[model samples]
Target: MGASFFSFSFSMVSFSSLRSSLVPTRMMGVEGQWWRTSGNHWRAEGRDDRMRGENEEDSKLSLDFTSEEKMEIESIKTYKKDLLDDIQKLKMEIDSVMAEILSFESAEENKTIERNKQFSNGKKKFNMDPKKGINYLVEHKLLDKRAQSIAEFLYKEEGLNKTAIGEFLGEREELHLQTLKAFVELHEFSDLNLVQALRQFLWSFRLPGEAQKIDRMMEAFATRYCDCNAHVFQSTDTCYILSFAIIMLNTSLHNPNVKDKTTLERFISMNRGINNGEDLPEDLLSKLYESIRNEPFKIPEDDGNDLTHTFFNPDREGWLLKLGGRVKTWKRRWFILTDNCLYYFEFTTDKEPRGIIPLENLCVREVPHPRKPYCLELYNPNSQGQKIKACKTDTDGRVVEGKHQSYTICAASAEERDSWIEAIRASITKDPFYDLVSVRKKKVINQTPQD
Candidate 1:
């Protein structure tokens, strides 16, 4: 049987009324099958496109990749195409259904067949123009009647007999529910599709919590964007949704001020030793510090050369985001630390990364949590000289009274970065009296790191 669909965007909502918390009441039904309103509430969701086509040659590139990577790339290339084709098929089917409705009837016909046997079964079903039928029902609301207990009365209304009303309502209800069902089902399909779409990206980038938050970021972006304001969250890998979200986030939501590039640079300059890597050159640490300190707010360029990009006021404005966590440290001897220090860099829209910051220069300060003592700390590897002092110095990190305490930390991954911004911003607006701009802050000093 052909089905009639309920056409509504995700944002489309109708309500009897909604009450806030202060207006308390307990009027919800206690026993009725809440779901029985219609066997038709669930509708099918969107499907993945069977065909994936990336206009970018790099998206389909097999060059500079290992055999294994190449195979994965090929698979993705194939899957994307398949997904694209699937969406086309659904679109075509919807068109066909719409065309069919041009001849479908909208209401009951009083003309009598009198059970006459011209076609065989003693009774013949009547056919009506789908379009006129739709117009009639829409204009009259003949097909959307709500029976309180739909299931108990399902197919039991004798008055609905021999009329187009029964056929129209019955089929429409199924479609309405089917549409909702399809709506949700599409997400499940997209879940796999998204993972597939990002398979290469995930393998290519060494991001923290890469897959974990891509879904949420795209979701928030979709909500932040869409002109239709559609809230229907389908699959997780919603780049399309994200495209919409960026538009929304930019145009509608309250925007936080671009952080101070100078302040950000001061913080990084004061604490620049954390990014030293074991794999990097023996002298890489010194150069890395010099590079990071020189231009703490610059983006790396790809012109076969490195320039001073960390400086605050470059010709171009961008963002510099740095995240790091402590792995291990030696003590009283080699890579020893008298205390622990954590740091995170919150940069201006123009801040960019010219080079990596060293671990010793790292200082992480958390935006105060609701009920906990907030912390800011700086880790200075050597107080005096670079050489390992042939002997131990002053009572080993002598206690400096009530000072900063270090805690294990995690940095936001590229995927979680946007979501983390959301989480952080939510806390910022929680206190009505707190205005970020009004608050006075100096080049805040992290309490000297204490063990």
Candidate 2:
């Protein structure tokens, strides 16, 4: 009985030990499950954050795309608006041309009715020859009227269509006819080719805007050359236009002083006298040559005394030598001598002036050139020694304060130097109001003592 009881106690102790080991194993399993759950939660949160960032980026891209679309729409609208404005302007021009055409047609109908009535009554007063009508229109300086008449005469009286005209005329004549047709059709503004042709026609006149009467006369002659004057010019006549251009240029030279001359004056001035339209005369040619040579120095006829009152004169251009700050350097500059100021540009015509020297309170003297052969010095006693911004120099600058500001300029030749000096002196001495006094003094000096 004692042995059995001891064995039972040992078994109970073994069972308790086994149960303690099983408890530790279960606790480790629970701790691993809790850690895995926490890791999964952290990973899910990171994924959510990534998705949110992607969504924000997508939204910004969409906004940028929307703005681009808006800008494109706005640009298209602006282009459309510009096109509409141009179309509107073209419509207005068309309306004005239509009005002119209506007025012209009404006047033509009235004249025609009157002529037909007179002819029907056996008066026999009307000449239906288009040539005579065109000649009269040209002589009257009715250019716009001539354009319509010539077009009608070509189309109706001659029964010449565009294709027929092209087949009948030479290549040059065909082109001229086509240009006239375009002008008659009044599509010149819309057609770029016709516009260029019209510009060429206007430029052939070689006169100012104020010369409207001359312009009209020239235009009439041009239209007549295509119509009534066709008898004078053959299909192969290339010299007609060239001869006319020469005659017009010669006329301008023959009488430069005549401001209000007629087309007849221009026609008479030609060596061939309008009938043949030849070159200029020897006297006129010589005069043109002389005027061109002296044009730069000549004072404008309308404003001869501008030098006494104005600060700038844009008509004259020439060359001069300017002394650099360095002792040995002299640069050639294109100088423009204005009324009260002198500006120097670069040697090229397109470049703007580099410096301006005011002639007011200025004194000029011929200086013996050390570096420059024929030099002159201009001094302004009132100026400070301030260096001109346009006068770029490397050595020392001229004094531009209290003392005189001196500018030394050179000339290519002695004659040029003398001319510049004389011009400067004349500019300084000119008194516009003293012209009457000078004339009176001259008259008194010429008068006899007995009087």
**1-451: candidate 2 lDDT, tens digit per residue:** 8999999988878655433332222221212211112122211122211333545544543543356644653464366457657777999999999999999999999988876553333211112332334445445443234445445443343222222222211123443344354433432223222113333333221221112222233343345344533442232122233333343333343434336543434333432322232333545434433442333122223334322122111234578878765354677888876555677766666355666676666767788975667788887556547543233322254433222247788988785776576456545543321342233334433444331
lDDT of 2: 0.43
Query: What is the lDDT, from 0 to 100, of the residue 33 in candidate 1?
Result: 22
- Tens-digit lDDT string for candidate 1 (1-451): 1232233322133221111111212113222221111223211112232212433434434333346745764575466557657777999999999877754532212112321222112111222332243444334433332332221122333222222322332233554233222222222222232223222222211111122222333333233323223332222223332232222222222222323332333333433321121111324224333433353211112111111111110112123222222223211111111112111223333132222222333333344433223222223333522321121112353322221233222223332323333223222222211222112111112122222
lDDT against the true structure, per candidate, is 0.28, 0.43
- The local distance difference test score of model 1 is 0.28
Task: Name the weakest run of 10 consecutive residues (lDDT summed) in model 2.
Answer: 30-39
Count of clashing residue pairs in every prediction:
77, 6
- Best-performing candidate as measured by lDDT: 2
